[model samples]
Target: MRILVVEDQDSIRRMIEALVQARGYEVTAVSSGAKALDVILTAPHDLVLLDLMLPGQYDGFEVCRRLRADPSTRAIPVFIISAMDDPESRRKATEAGANAFYTKPFSPIALLKEIERLTTGKG
Candidate 1:
C-alpha cells in the first residue's frame, strides 16, 4: 500500500517515513501542505498521514476539505497526526473529513495498528 506523510518538521517527517516504510508500505513524504496537495492530486495513495499545523497556503484542515470535496479523491483515507490536542482541533479535524486523529506523542504501535486497519481492513 502507498501512504503519503505530510509533516513540516524535518525530524518528525523522517521518523514517520521510517516507521511507515518499516511496515512494508510505500511512503511519500512532504514538508508542506501545498506539496502534499500537489502530490496527492497527481497520484494515488492508500492513506494520508497529515499534520494540522503545516506550512504554505493549505493547512491540514484545508487539505482534508479539498480532498473530500474532490470526487476523485474523496474516498481516500485521511489520518491526522498532529500536535493540536484540544477539543476544538479535534472537532475541526472531524468536520474537515479526517478518518482518524492522533495527537502528538501518540503511541507508534497504535498509529501503526490504525494504519494497518485502514489500509488492509485488519487491525
Candidate 2:
C-alpha cells in the first residue's frame, strides 16, 4: 500500500519511511503540512501517518481537517503520530477524523501492526 508520512523531525521522518518501506509499502515523506497537502492532493495514498506538530501555517489538526474536507482524499485512513500526548491533543485528533492515535517514541511493532491493520483490514 501507498502511505504518506507528514512529520517535521528529520530523524523521525526518515525512520518512519524506512520502517514502512521495509514492510513492502510505498511511502512518501514530507516535512511540513503544506507539502503534505500538496502531495496528497496530487497523488493517491492508501494511508497517512500525520504528526501533530508541523512548521508553517497549518498544524497537523488543520492538515487532517483539510484532508477530511476534500472528497478525493477524505476516505483515506489517517493515523496521528505525534508527541502531543495530552488528552486535548487526542481529542482534537479524533475530532479531525483520524483513524488512530499514537504518541512519540511509539512502539515500532505496534505501529507496524496498526498500519498493517488499517491497510489490510486485519489487526
Q: Give a tens-digit lDDT track for model 1, residues 22-97.
A: 9899999999888988999999998999999998899999999999999988999999999999999999999999
Return the TM-score for candidate 1, rounded to 2 decimals.
0.97
lDDT for 103 in candidate 1 is: 91
lDDT of 2 by residue, 14-62 (tens): 9999999999999999999999999998989999999989999989999
**Which parts of model 1 are misplaced by more than 4 Å?**
none
* Model 2 lDDT-worst window of ten: 114-123
Q: Give candidate 2 misplaced runs (Cα > 4 Å).
A: none
Which pairs clash in model 2?
A: none
Model 2 / residue 44 / CA error / Å: 0.6
